[model samples]
Target: MFEKILIANRGEIACRIIRTAKQLGIATVAVYSDADANSQHVKQADEAIYIGESPASQSYLQMDRIIQAALDTGAQAIHPGYGFLSENDQFALACEKNNIVFIGPPVAAILAMGLKATSKALMEKAGVPLTPGYHGTNQDADFLKQQADGIGYPVLIKASAGGGGKGMRLVERGADFLGALSSCKNEAKSSFGNDEVLVERYVMNPRHIEVQVFGDSHGNYVHLFERDCSVQRRHQKVLEEAPAPQMAEAKLEVMRQAAIDAARAVNYVGAGTVEFIVEQDGTSYFMEMNTRLQVEHPVTEMITGQDLVEWQLRVAFGEPLPKLQHELHIHGHAIEARVYAEEPEKGYLPAIGKISYLHYPEQNQNVRVDSGIVDGDEITTYYDPMIAKLIVWGKNREAALVQMHHALGHFHVEGLGNNIAFLDRIIRCDSFKHARLDTNLIQREDEFLFKNIQKANAQLIISAAFTALLSLFKQNITANNPVWQAESLWRLNISNSYPIKFKLDDENILVNFSPVEHGFIAEYQGQNYQVSGTLIDQNSIHIEIDGKKDKLAFSQNETALTLFSNAQNFKFAYIRPDFNTDDSDSNDHNLKAPMPGVITKVLVSANDHVKKDDVLLTLEAMKIEYSIRAPQDGIIAAAYFQVGDQVKAGDELVEFQVLAEDVA
Candidate 1:
């Protein structure tokens, strides 16, 4: 084994590799960007090195700096975990030239399958099932449009060099192909610095299934079953699981063999994944191969009872395959849900902020959480916004699905919006449970997944009220005098009751509280309930509401109060009745950046007329582009931001002037 290994990535994957390296008695070195100075991955490594600025291009993507760090730390091998340079063939070759072992595939294998169009052609020649479309080298726009026309409408234009849905666009008709193709090329150029693209038929209701394949330098290979990654949004996976549900044995073996063949075709070494698009009729087509450790590899680990990182390390050390194909067997079913710092209601735009309080569920044999985040960590806009992955195992698929829902429900995060509730709802939905999954599951089950979770749950609704009151009481408390803490907040001597205004989302709630001998009485919406509570622990509150005992997990910050209970998380914000927010606001015609990001495009200049929903400017953050649009028909009065300008959330981007008649 190597004496030291440098992790060429950050976040949970880096932490995961560090754990395995420590067990193997190998020292681990972590390379971090400026934004990750105090990150959890940095703290976990045996040694840490600063690379460059926060943006990946200046830091993580600096191949030379990363290589130098490995050499400086005496790291014999560098593990590129999943993203960033994990699949960059140049980085792999650079490592080889530097005489530092790259814990990944050989350069030949990477080159063979690096670009989508080239790989698709290779697969087609190798007789690997491929989607019927254009995967040619011609980059001419008109030529690509003609190809799309031949492939029929609903064609997908995708970046030929990168994955994760970057530079991908779906065109519904020939007339819209040019616009979609242009946007896709721009995104591809911005994201991967490559404008080349490929066209494919957009198969509706397709499920994404990938087989895990590993190879050795000695030409040995095996397939470790498969994972279903169909539940997605914006063409990115939200949840994944091993032993794809509803998969038949014959079809599994066929796909497994195809994956092994794909690896063999590239002379692939170490761990890799061969993805496919599965149709409803049991047919599958080759997608692409990921050349490094995957984000959802834990589910495979949970089911196979093996550490994939250990395998990666052993393989990179020139060791033979850990076990032959016949020696491995699936022990149980496993599922993983990716929790991200995003708001699903807001088009799943990434939410960036300091994490006030973070807690995953109590982990055990059946439940596991892999995260490189702590309570005070920051989710900056410099990189991917994934917070953590929740993995669960069970004896069967049904049981695993149940465990996933339970795990996601217990996962709590605050100070930034997250998709925990959205994930929980997804796993619990009837279609998901019945195994009716596809890439469109989120869309098909939108009504149920996005429904108000607190509407029918009286306990959760009341808990939100209790949380708001207790938060206010605690803020008034101090170490100066313990008695003044509760007394100053309640004012029981002078006033028995007071109206406290609060808000949940857009609803304004008026909660009336009055002091009682043993506890307090609170009323809302013409309903009264007796409430008494004392914090049992830092995150749990022991409360008796109307003589009913309940314990709720709680946390608070300056602006919002949160409570987790009954498999639900409720956040309530205190509203000040004295402040008239509408009176102080300026005209509503102005455009604002929805979140902090760097401006990438300015579609309109001052005095330019635009219709409602016209894209005025584009902002890029968290590796995704957000379009700021005109709220109403208006003329641009002033453009405050230009391309490449860094903007904070809600920062003014373009001020507009709307005529009263036009606005009406």
Candidate 2:
């Protein structure tokens, strides 16, 4: 085994690899960018090296700097965890030339499967099942439109070198093909530097099931079963699980054998995944192969009792396969939810800030969390927005689902918006519980699934009110004196009726509180309640209200106060009584950057009259393009930013002239 291995990545996957390497008595080296200087992964590694600046192109994607760091540290092998240079063929070849082992598949296999169109053609030739579409090298707009016409409407135009849904577009009609194709090509060129694309039939209600395959240099290989990655938004997976629920035994065997065959056909080595799109009828088609450890690999690890990182290390050392095809066994069901720093209600835009407060639930036999962030870490805009991954395991699928729901509720993160509430809603959906999932699940049921979770539970409101009252009393006691007696104040205001109204969601609640033993007694709608608890800190209170015990944590800063309970975080504040109290001069009619990004194009010019929804400009961030639209029907009074300018979130890009009719 190698004495030291360099991890050429950051975030949760970097931390995950270091953990297994430590368990195996191996020292680990971590590489980080400027943004990740104080990251959790950097602190956990035995040795750390500074790579480059915050931008990935300057840091994580710099192959030479990474290889030099490995050489400087005397690392025998380099492990590319998931993204960045993980699947770069040239990086693997560079390691081979430098006599440093790459803990992944060989360069040839990576090159073979890296291009989507090329891989699809290769699979077809090798007798692997493929979707019926155009994989030819035709790039002309008219030619592609003809192909789409032949394939029928609702076709998918995918980048030949794309992954993670970048450079992809779905066209519902032939008339819209040209514009969508142009958008896809532009995105592909910017994201992957490859503009080649392929058109295919968009499979409706198709479940994304991928089989994990591992191989050795000696041409030995085996499959580690499958993971269902159907819960997605914008073609990116948000949740995943191993041993797909409601999957027939016979179909599973077929997928397993096909995955093994796909690996053998390419002479694949190290850890790789063969992805497939399975329809409702149980028929599956080959998608593409990922020639590196996946972001969702933990689900497979939990179900199979195998450390994929360990396997990568062993395979790089030229070891033979540890087990044969028949030796592998799936023991239990496991699910993983990717917690991202994005707001689902706000179109999942990336959120960035310092993590003021972070609380992770305790790990047990069934629940596991993999994260590379902490309370004080800064979530910058330079990298992927995934904050952490929550994984849970159980003896059965239903049990695993239940445990996953509970785990998501316990995860508390503040100072930035997240998709925790969105994840909780997904797991509780009837269609999801019945395993009726598909790639379009998020788009199909987004309105119902992404609704505000804080407003759903009535019990939570009472709990928050009780906890809030306790906090007020605790603050009074603490402010008065350190050793002040609560008994003396208990008798003074026992019957002083004071009405306090609070808003939970859309509803308002009126309650009366009076001093009581230990805490306060709350009365609402003729219900007598004894709420008692000592405040732990500014953020949390332990109390029993109306014979129901609850632990509530409240975080109040200048802007908002979020209450954590029932495994979900709820934001509450004193709703200002007056609506027009703020300074009117601060209400500027200007278009601002939603997030830090490079302006790709400016669709409007100064003095141009525009209507609401008119495109003003487009910005690219983290490989996703977002168009900034006009807020109202107005003239573009001034354009502050131009194409190719880098702008930060809230930085003004354009000024809109308010019309007299609109001023009212």
Candidate 3:
């Protein structure tokens, strides 16, 4: 085995590679950009090197810098841990030219599968099942539209280069084809430097199942079963699992063989995944082959008892296949949830900030957390927002799901919005539980999934009031008695019998609280109860109400508080005070950036007339593009940003002049 390998990546995947390298007694070097100087992956490596600035193009994607770093650190091999330069054929060839092993597929394989159109043609020639579509080299828009017409309605236009739903569009009709095609081509050109596209027949109900394949330098290969990645949002996977639920052995065999054939077609070596789009009838089609390790490889590892990264290392050292295909067996059901720092209610925009408080649930034999962040770390907009991959294993799918739900509830993170609540809702949904899933599951059930439920409970109001009271008490006691002990006695009294109201969804709850012995007495609806607790920390309060045997863990902030108990989390929020009845409303209106991102395009100029829902500008962040729209019919008074300007959340990008009659 090589003595040292340079991990040419950052974040979770870098940490993942480092852990395996350490297990193999191989020294690992990490490369980081300025934005990732304090990242956890950097701290875990044996040695670290600064590559370049924050922008990926100047740093992570800088082939010369990464190659030099590897050479300087005396690394014999370089592991491109997915994303960034993982699939860059030139980078792989550079390693060969430098006499350093590239810990992935050969350069020829990467070039073969780098372009979607080329890959499709290759798969077709190899007799692999393919979706019916156009793979012609012609770039004429009219010809593409004609091809889409021949393929029927609801076709997909995809960029020949890159993935992650970029430069992809779904056109339901012929009339909208040209416009959507132009937009998709523009996005593809901007994202991948390639405007070429291919038209494919869109599967109505597609289940994303990918098989993990490994190859050695001796021309030996084996498959590690498959993972079902059907749960997705905006064409990106959210949750994944191994040994797809409700899948039959026959269909599994078909997919397994197809995956092997796809890999062999490219003479693939090292770790790669062959992804397929399976229909509801059990028929599957080859989607594309990922030339490197995948983000959801952990799910496959959990089920097969294989360390994929270790395999990558062994193969890079020119070792033969570790095991025969017949020796691999599916051990148990495993599930993985990708916890991201994004708000589900806010269109899943990337959230960035300091993680003031972070806590991972206690791990057992069945549960595991692969994370690349710490409590004090900041989640910035310069990189992917995935915080961690929480995975769980069990004897059966149901048991694994139960454990996963519990683990998600127990996991706590603060200082930025996240999708834990949304994930919980997804796992608990009836359709998901029944395994009635497809690529469009999130979009079809988005309304039910992203609804905020914390605003409905009366306990939320009580929790907020208790939190405010605790904060006030702490301030007063500290100001008056600097040396006050934790056991110091304190009492508070209520002034008026005002009702505290809370609202979630459309439901309202009213609660009243008054002073009592040690704590407080509270009444909601027709029930009366006694509540007592001490502030355990800045965010949580240990409370016992009405002689409950179990102590409740309550966390409160300005907007919401979650009551945690029995490995379940119930969210609550303070009711917005009614100020409209007394205070006059301000009439200032402006368009703001929803998240920190670079302004990609300005759709409207100053003094331009626009209707409600007209495109105002586009912001690109975390590799995703979002188009901001006008809230109402108005004239653009001013525009604050041009293309390529970086802006933060709530930063005004445009101002509108509302008519006198339109102003409320």
Candidate 4:
């Protein structure tokens, strides 16, 4: 094996590679952009090198820079961890030219399967079952539309060179074909620098299944069984599991053979995934091939008891297959949940902010966490917002899900939009627990998930009160004040009530309280309550209200506090008595940016009248497009920004003027 290998990616995957490399007694080097200077991956690697700017094009995708860095650091090989330059055929060829081993498939394999159209044709020729679609090279819009028309409505417009659902659209009618095509093309061009698309018949109620295949230079090949990635949102997987539930052994064998054939067809080596779209009836059709390690590979690892990264390195070094196809067998069931820093209530708009507190479930033999972040890390708009991946294992699917639900309860985050609560709900939902999964899991379970942000429940309100009182008590102790030492201060009277107002979402709660024997007597929402608290830390506390105890988490700013408990996050602002006396209405006409992002398009300009629900602007953050619409019919007084402008959260994008007659 080579002495040193440089990782050509950043974030969790890079860190993941580094971990395996270290166990193999191999030295690893990490390359980072300015944004990831202090990243956990950088700290974990044996040595680190500075790359280019934050944007991938200038840094992670800068093939020349990455190659030169590897060479300059005396590294013998480069591992392209999944995303950046992993599937770039040119990069593989470049590595071959430089005499540095590329720990991935060959250039020929990448080229053969790089584009969807070419890959589809090759798969068809290779006798792999394929979906009915148009994978032609004809780029004319009319020609594609005609193909879509012939294929029937509800066809899928997929970017020829897309993954992670970046450039995909489902058109349900001929009237929406052109618009869908336009949107798909734009997103494709922006994401992959390829606007070409393929039209295919959309599979209704489909489950995504992918087989893990590996190969060596000696022409030996084996399969690591399969993973079902059916639970998805926006065509991207949210959770994945190994040895798909309800999948028969006979069908799995057939798919495994087909996957091996697909790999042998391309002469693929190292780690790769052969994806299939399986109908409800168990008929599977080839979707596409991913030529590198998958994000959900941990589920396969936990079930198969195999280290895929180690396999990749061994094969890259010309080693034979570690185990024959017959020798590999699935063990316990495993599931992986991708925890992202994106909001669910706000249409999953990517949230960019400092992660004030970050903690994952405690790791054990059954539960594992693979992450690239720590507390105080910032979730910026320059990169994907995935915080970590939670993987759990059990003897059966039901037990695995039970473990997953328990693990999610321990997963915590603050000061950003996250999907932890959503994950929790999915794991515990009756449908999900029964394994009724598909690509529409989010849509099907939307009712029970993300229930209108979080209202100020009694638990949260009491937790907040405890936290505030604790601070005051600590301050008095530090100052040697005797006020808190007196039991009379515990009982609030006409002269002792200290009114504190807090804003929760759009509603406000006022509480007046004083110290009491064994607890505190607090009045909130026109009721008095007994509350007790134990300080866990400056940022965490255990509180009890009326005999109900809750271990809650909280963080505070100058005028606000964010409290998290029981899978819910409540934002509260400390309404100071001196700050603002204005009970006037807020500026509802101004459409503010929900998060920090660049304005991709400004649909309306100054004085443009817009109807309610009209698309006024669009924001692109964390590689997702969010449309900002007008809440009600209004006249635009002025446009605050134009296309390609960068804005922060709460920055108004448009100012509206309401005429008296129209308002009346």
What is the model-wide C-alpha lDDT for candidate 4?
A: 0.86
Question: In candidate 4, residue 57 scores what lDDT?
Answer: 79
Those runs of model 2 whose alpha carbons end farther than 4 Å from true positions after fitting are 456-462, 465-469, 472-484, 487-512, 517-519, 523-528, 536-540, 556-560, 574-582, 586-589, 658-664
lDDT of 1 by residue, 1-664 (tens): 8999999999999999999999999999999999999888899999999999999899999999999999998999999999899988899999999999999999988887889998988888777999989999999999999999999989899999879978889899899999998999999998888999999999988999999999998889998899999999999999899889898889988899999999998889999999999998769999999988888899899999988999999999999999999999998899999999999978998998999998889899999999999888999989888999999999999899778877776788988889888888888888888889899999999889886564525555566666666655653222332323475543545765657665776788777777666666778788888877766556777777789887677787666678776456677777755665576578676678788999999999988988889999999988888888888887888999889999998888888888679857
For each candidate, give its TM-score against the true structure. 0.94, 0.93, 0.91, 0.92
How many clashes (backbone N, Cα, C below 3 Å) per candidate?
Answer: 0, 3, 3, 2
TM-score of 4: 0.92
Q: Which tens-of-lDDT digit does each residue in 1-664 have in candidate 2?
A: 8999999999899999999999999999999988888887899999999999999999999999999999999999999999889989999999999999999988889998999988888888888889889998878889999999999989999999999988999999888999999999988998898999999998988999999999999989899999999988998999999988888889887888888888888899999999998988788999899999899998998988888888888888999977786787898899999998888888889888887888886798799999998887878778888889999999999999889888887788998888887888888887788888898887777667765445535455555665555455454333243213532333443555445566556556767766544455667777767655557777677667667777676676644457876556776655557677678666468878888888999988889999888899998876678999987888998888888999999998888887768877
The residue ranges of model 4 lying beyond 4 angstroms of the native Cα positions read 452-456, 475-501, 510-517, 520-533, 539-550, 556-561, 578-587, 602-616, 630-642, 655-664
Q: Given candidate 2, what's the lDDT at residue 269?
A: 91
Give Cα distance to truth, residue 256, candidate 4, Å.
Answer: 1.7
- lDDT ranking, high to low: 1, 4, 2, 3
Query: Which residue pairs in candidate 4 collide?
Result: 490-515, 490-516
Kindly indicate the candidate among 1 and 4 with the higher TM-score.
Answer: 1
Q: Which parts of model 3 are misplaced by more than 4 Å? A: 452-456, 460-520, 523-527, 533-542, 554-587, 660-664
Task: Report the Cα lDDT for residue 86, model 4.
Answer: 93
Residue by residue across 1-664, what tens digits does model 3's lDDT show?
9999999999889999999888989999999999999888899999999999998998999999999999999999999999999999999999999999999999999999999889988999888899889987898999999999999989999999959768889999999999999999999999888999999999998999999998887877788999999999888899999988888889989989888888888999999999999998789999889999999999888988889898889888998878889899998899999999998888887889987667787787689999898887898888889888999999999999999988987788777878887888888777788898788888767666865344334454465555555554563222233212322433235263335555544556666766544456778878777766666677566555676523345555666666664333455556786666743453357878888899999999989999888999999999888999988888999999999999988898898887666776
lDDT, each prediction = 0.86, 0.84, 0.83, 0.86
- Candidate 1 vs candidate 3: the lDDT winner is 1
Residue 232 in candidate 4, Cα distance off native in Å: 1.2
RMSD of each: 3.1, 3.2, 4.2, 3.3
